[model samples]
Target chain A: MEPVDNRAVVDLLGALAYAELTAFDRLAEDARLAPTLAGRAALARMAAAEIAHHSRLTDRIADLGIDPATAMAPFVSALDAFHNSTRPSTWLEGLVKAYVGDGLAADFYREIAAFLPPADRALVEEVLDDTGHSDFAVREVRAAVSANRKLVGRLSLWARRLVGEAMSESQAVIAEHDRLAELIVAGTGDLGGVAQLIDRITSAHTDRMKTLGLNP
Target chain B: MEPVDNRAVVDLLGALAYAELTAFDRLAEDARLAPTLAGRAALARMAAAEIAHHSRLTDRIADLGIDPATAMAPFVSALDAFHNSTRPSTWLEGLVKAYVGDGLAADFYREIAAFLPPADRALVEEVLDDTGHSDFAVREVRAAVSANRKLVGRLSLWARRLVGEAMSESQAVIAEHDRLAELIVAGTGDLGGVAQLIDRITSAHTDRMKTLGLNP
Candidate 1:
């Protein structure tokens, strides 16, 4: 195992905390797009779960003596930009964003979790609890695609765009934060290793899309 | 004591359940209007707590052999209408609404809970937990009102609008459901009794508004 960089660990956790907070915000907003009260409540529950995860991450950051806001500040723009770019215009789009977009980001962070020191790794892993988000998302998205075949195409495109924006933001973070990038390479070993990590995230994301009957 | 109307209890619970669900939705929407991430996250947490309460109420409704959706369905429109009518046009309004508006509803339900049969009463009391929503709201709204004295007029108007819309909907619910209304009158014993109850609610609300330096 490569030597750990404490600064990078803090950076990673900060990014994850802000991601969960923003995800909570986005999902809560998207819950409004739900077609029925039951559907809306279900989405809201998922949104709540994100906040639960966020509190854990934020508390963990505080426990580490980092001013959570300072650590979280740099990544807020990148995360907020991704959401702004992929604003869902419909209930179905919101569903896809909550399910697919969140899963992709989760996968990306889970990869980095492996590189984390044990205490921090545990915090990362714990905060990533899905609380049935993927199951609900998959079930709902698949049902929609089954009901309207054309949605598979449009939603597939939306899923692709979400990933495009997310990846660009991910690249921006990597470019700006050398320590975090180094942690990734250290976890995977080198440049090819880093490429493999991307491949892994893409593969998982594609699998999730396919499960929802959307194109990879 | 008035004989418990099982159907009315279910109706009351259903309405409460849906009210909590929509409150969750409205708060989540209002969270986006927050001026800072911390404030946004704070509102989101409150929103999540509403959904948490909604779940408990829905579960208790099922325990009474009512379909949770069927229970929640009737109140959806009234609650949704109230939210639509009182949509906060600014962040301060959102803060004020969460405080005064929800406190009003909670107080009203606290009145109803007193009339409920034991199991239902416990459920209602438990779900209505403020979890310090009023405190968070009061502190935030007071700070804003203090910083901008002119905000007092706009916010006081918003608070009154919120309560007005809420009261009309409250009347509609009572009118539409005789059993529930009967329970209320039965619990308090007649017109003056109901009047006194309203007075109590108004008093609490007035104290809250004064604390925030807004007109009741």
Candidate 2:
């Protein structure tokens, strides 16, 4: 593994920051899909955390002497496309998306955080890890699953689709961000090594599915 | 001013909390109407702060052994009616709603906060106040008004309608919750005193309008 530079780390942080911002917006929109007021408020609270994370990352990007919007631009389309292609059609679907989809994304982010420089890495770690967020999602998904065992099949399928879309976007981000790819290479070596990193993401995702009592 | 009891303070705090939660949800939804990413994000950030306020109030309600949902229920219809009656039609109108409408609402909450028990009053004073939020709304409105002088007239009309609806709802909440009304009465005394309070609120609002370069 080679050593990563400041620019790649900054770009990576920028992408994560904008991702959080956009997620907050999208999840807030999706909260309307919730079946109950409690559900709606829960999702809105989660969305709020995303924006808070975005604010922290934005501050870091500014400290790096980079315009936040400029640094965030490259991943906008990939992130938007990920969301657009996977709009949930129902309350259950929305919950599933928030639970299953975000878990996988966070796992990938957790892996990438290790590749960042110490200060940048801490920011990535801080922003990407949302324990309050994940617990809520997991609990919501579990309650729904327990309430109606029949929901498992459809939810599992939805979860799979969300995972697939996320994987596609993750690959697209990698392809475009040669600098980021370079950073990963510095930390973990060759392209094949990077591919293994995704396999690990997939394994963690399966663990999440099992945690939700879904088939791995 | 009359002293406030725990139940009355709880009612007021719960109402404010739910108002913040609902505002966060609606503003996040309305953010989609923004033509630019920056505009959407600004609204999203504002919405996030509302949730942070909501969480604090929710915790306090729980501490008082009240169901947050039950405490929130009475104000929901009035809040919904107010927002529904004053929906913005343009991006500038949205900014005006955020600036003028939220400014008025925050002012009202601050006034009411003074009528509560000491702990609740301090919580209300501390938790709901965010200078960052008001500054963003002010900046957005100022930019819009400065960019197009004609926007002032339409937004002024919108502001009047928003205030009217808010007034109607405020009266409804007062009528429905006698204990809460009594707390306000106790804090400021009878009809004449309350009228003076209203006058103060109105004067402050007028000053806010002038600051926005809108006609009072």
Candidate 3:
């Protein structure tokens, strides 16, 4: 096996850590859109789970002898821009975003994880674990969509927008961080390899959207 | 001791449950004001802790055969009003509000806990545990104040406004909920007992402010 690139690993961890932090922020913010106290609490619990994962990723980054914040700083703008541009306007939109958006990001990260050493791979996978949010989002969105079929169309469009914004942000992040881009290219083995990776991610996202009864 | 007042117990739990939920919301929102990612993560972690406590309180309320949402519904308006009235405009104000505001609330709740049965009191105390936010807020606020002497006046005023808003909201809540008021009166033994409760909470608030190097 080839030796791991420490800089690439740091970039991956940093990106993941900041992603979790923002996930926590956005999820918590979206909880306000919940129509019921129970719904709000469910989203808040999911948000809390993100912070726990964030702490784990940051701890691993520190174990690598890098300051977690310093490592995370470079990716902040791109991540913030993605979230800002895709802010959900309604409760179902928020749920769909949490499910579809996070599902896409998790799938992408999991693919990247295969390139890391075993320990780092395990860390990435663990942090990306669904934290029961998938079930909650699925149940909520499915129930809502079933009650009002009109929601399917709006939410499908919302999901597409989420993916589009995420793709642009991901591209920006990769373009700005050379080592991170190298890690991706190295893992995929070529530009074609990267295309195949996106294919896999897109396929997974379609399955997720179908599970939520939304159009891919 | 007198038989536990089930309605009062439920009301108290409901109030605390909603309070924690809003605390989670406000703290998570305030995190965006943090000057650094490390500072942001610290606030986000504290916000997560509030959700954990909220879960526990809601669980106990459920164990008593009450729907958590129904129990929490009564206090939502009061709690929301308090938070809306005192939204912090800056990072230091947010820290002071978290420290002084939460410190006062905890002090009051602890006093009320003494009036409950052992098991219920234990639950209240457990959910009200500091969650490490106290030290973080104190350290940050004190450092900020020391570095800029002019901040003392602004933060002190902010702390005072927090207490004032909290007091008025508490009055509204107690007046609105008859059983909760009975719990306080019965526990304190009379109207003077209620006065003393406020006195104790106020004194502790003053001490917390002093600890943060702000005026009471």
Candidate 4:
């Protein structure tokens, strides 16, 4: 096996750490949109889970001798732009975004984790592990979508936009970080392998949307 | 010992639960003001701690055969009003609010918890336990005030306003809930007991402000 690049590892962890941090911020903000206290608490719980993941990622980055803040700084703008662009306007939209948007990012990271060294891969997998709150999102979104078929159209459009914004920001991040891009290409065995990885992520995203009773 | 009044217990727990919920929301929102990712994560962790306490409080409320949401509904407006009026405009202010404002509330609750049944008292004490993040707030606020002596006057004023608003809203809440008010009065042995309780909380608040290098 080829040796892994340390800078690439830092970049990947940095990006992932920032992603979790912003996920916490957005989900917590979106909780206020919940119509009920119970609903709000559920969303807040999901946001808390993101913070825990973020702390772990930052801890691992620190163990690698990088200042976690410095490492996370590079990706802050891209992730923030993605979240800012995809802000959910309502409780149901927030639920769907948490389910679909985070699921897509997790899937992509899992795909890339395969190319990392064992330790980094393990950390990635641990951080990406579902917080078990997806069931709440899936249950809530499916119930709402089923009750009002009209929501199907709007939420479906929202989900697609979320994916589009995510992918655009992700590509920009990769483009700016050559080590990260090289790592992805090398892990895939070639550019074709990267294409296959994208295909896998897209397919999983479709399944996730379907599970949420939304169009892919 | 007089049997604990179920209505009063419910009211107290409800108020505390809603306070936790809003604390989670406000702290998470304030985290965006943090100057660095590490500082943001620290505040986020504090916010997450509030959610955990909220979950426990809600669970305890449910155990008493009340819907957690129903229990929390009554205090929502009061708690929300307090947070809305006391929104922090900067990172240092947010840290001070979390430290001083929450410390004041916790001191008040701990005083009242003494009059409750063992189980209810235990729950109150547990939820009010500091999340150990106060050190972070103290360290940061002190360092900032020392570097910029001008911050002391503004932040001291902020701290006073926080307590003033807190006391005003708290009086409103207690006035509206006869049973909760009775609980506090009885626990203190009379109306004077209530005043003494306020005195204790006030003294603690002053000490907290001093610790933060701000005048009370």
Candidate 5:
């Protein structure tokens, strides 16, 4: 793989770190929409895990001697736009957004982990795995839709909206960060390789949908 | 101790649980005002721990077959009012408020734990101690004020506002929940004992203020 410049890496890491911080804040607020105490706590734990990810990424940014906020400044609008546009309005909607939305982020980080230098690679790797709270979301989402059966149609629709908004923001980031895109593309060699990456993300998302008994 | 009604225990647990949930939300929001990423993450983790406490308290509430929200409802307005009225306008105010305010809750919970049934007592005992995060806040507050010297005067004044607002809301809660008050007075033995509980809370606040380089 071709060597990426430190500036590009810093920008990437800062954007990722800010994303984690905003995710933590957004998901923590979403926890309020939970129908049950168990559900609220489950989402809260997920929010908390984002802070851990935020910490690791922020530490790396600081070690590089860049102002973390300055590094993060460029992406703030896009991230905030993503969350504001896709804010969930119901308990079921919140769970689906968290499960489906964060699942996508976990996938993206795993893919990008391979492109990073060793120290940065390890940070990405550390963030790829899920906290146990996904099961809490799964349990609740499954119960809600499965009990009514017809509610699957509604939730599946909600899942699609989450994906759409996430993809929209991701495209905005890609357009904004050409250097970062070059790194991902350089690692894979071509559009087909990018297609394969998308395929994997799509498949994992499908598996999640099936787990919740929603039509993929 | 006379047998306390299970319903009363559920009410207390639910109130504490929701309080933790909202505290998590508020603190996560407040963390953004921190001057450094490390500082922000520290506050976020402290917020996260409150969510964990919420989880434990909520589980106990569910075990009692109560709808957690219903059990939490009676105290929601009063608690919300307290936070809304005492919203921290700056990073220092936020930190000092978190330190003094949560210190009060932890202290009160310690006193109220005595009035609870065994299981509930254990829950309160577990939730009361946040030694690491409290220590982190104490150190940060002290360092900030010590470095500037002038800031100490400002924060001490902020602490006074926090206590005054808190006391007003707390009195409302006490007046609203006769059973809870009965349980507290029963456990403590008299109005004098209640006064002593307040004294202990105040003494702890003084120690914390001293640690933060503020006047008691």
Candidate 6:
């Protein structure tokens, strides 16, 4: 790994931290869509996990002697817009968003993490560990679809719309943060490299959707 | 402490677990009312802590070979009703609920926790430890009230309404659960004893309200 600009690193951490915060907010609200207490608790647990991840990133940014709020400010609007655009209309839609939408975002971050210095890479990897919640989302979504076959079509369409909105928002954030863009480009070795990185993310996202019986 | 019925203990733990889970849901939703990222993260942290406590209670219920969902099912409607009736209208309202409303509930739970056997009592006390988030709520609510004097009257009314609904819901739950009623009566020594215990809790609640410049 090469030396990354500290400002760029902070930008990345800020984006990650705010992402988790907003994810926590969205998942917590979506948990309300659950028809059962156990189901609600499951989504709340996912929301809790996001906050735990948010804390790690925020703490790191604060350790850098920057106000976490200031560091997180830049990415808030884009992420908030992503959540606003992709608000789930039903319980199954919520589950699919938790699974497909968040999974793609996590994959993109993990890929970005790889080109950073060791410590930052490690932090990103640790916080992006979505394995437990991913399994929960997949199980719940699959069970629901099995019980109501018609939900499969609505959820499949929801997954694609979620990914599209997520990517659009991601692009908007990247465009505004030149330092962060430079860092990602450097990490991946070039803009073409960035394209290749996103391609790998897109492929994994397809697999995730397929696992949930939804189209990519 | 005397040997207590495990059935009753499970009942108590279940209720406590569900309370934490519901509180987590409410607090996480309320976090969106925060005006800034730091403020949002602060409320989310409180929400996260509730889930942590919920996990502790749920695990204990499962260890007793009782399904947590089954145990928690009985108390769901009352709690959901209490929260539904007292949903916050503003960020300050949310903070007041987190402060006064949750504080009152915690005090009542702690008082009731005393009548159980040592291990169960300890678990109750541990899970009811809301000191970290309580301090944050107090600081935030007090600051907001200081900024607007007329805000005091509305908030005081809000606090009163919260306690009234909480008590009504609590009475409804207790009336149905004889085993839990027995546990509490045992802890307090008698019906009169339970009254005395509630008095102590109410007094503490008054002090809490006064601390926030609100009338009891």
Local accuracy by lDDT, each model: 0.86, 0.82, 0.92, 0.91, 0.83, 0.87
Native-vs-model 5 lDDT? 0.83
True contacts kept of each: 0.79, 0.69, 0.87, 0.90, 0.59, 0.74
Q: For residues A60-82, what per-residue lDDT tens digits would candidate 5 score against the true structure?
A: 88899998888888888888898
**The best candidate in terms of DockQ:** 4
Q: Which regions of candidate 5 fall more than 4 Å away from where they truly are?
A: A1-13, A59-77, A117-123, A138-165, A175-179, A206-216, B1-12, B61-73, B114-122, B139-158, B213-216
Q: Which candidate ranks first by TM-score, i.e. highest?
A: 4
Estimate, for each residue in A4-96, the C-alpha lDDT of model 2 and write its tens digit: 777887788888887888789878988888776677788898898898888898889889998888888898899999999999888778877
Higher-ranked by TM-score: 3 or 5? 3
lDDT at position A188, candidate 5: 78
Collision pairs in model 4: none
Instruction: Give the interface-residue alpha carbon RMSD of model 1.
Output: 1.1
Candidate 6 regions with alpha-carbon error over 4 angstroms: A147-149, B1-3
lDDT of 5 by residue, B119-177 (tens): 78988889867748877788888888979999988999989988898889888898888
Question: CA RMSD for every model?
Answer: 1.7, 2.0, 1.3, 1.1, 3.9, 1.9
Listed models, DockQ each: 0.76, 0.69, 0.88, 0.92, 0.49, 0.79
Query: Model 3 reaches what TM-score against the true structure?
Result: 0.97
Judging by TM-score, tell me the better candidate of 2 and 4.
4
Order by DockQ, highest first: 4, 3, 6, 1, 2, 5
lDDT of 2 at A139: 84
Runs of candidate 2 with Cα error greater than 4 angstroms are B1-5
Model 5: residue B177 alpha-carbon error in angstroms: 3.4
Candidates in order, TM-scores: namely: 0.95, 0.93, 0.97, 0.98, 0.81, 0.95
For model 3, which pairs clash? none
A1-216, model 6: which lDDT tens digit per residue? 568888888888898998899889889999999987778888899999999899999899989889999998888789888999989988889888898888888888888777677888899999999648778788888887889888878888888889889888988888988987887888888778988998899899889878997756
Model 6 per-residue lDDT tens digits across residues B127-206: 88864867877888888889989999999999999999999999899899998888888777778988898889899999
Chain B TM-score (each prediction, in order): 0.97, 0.94, 0.97, 0.98, 0.96, 0.96
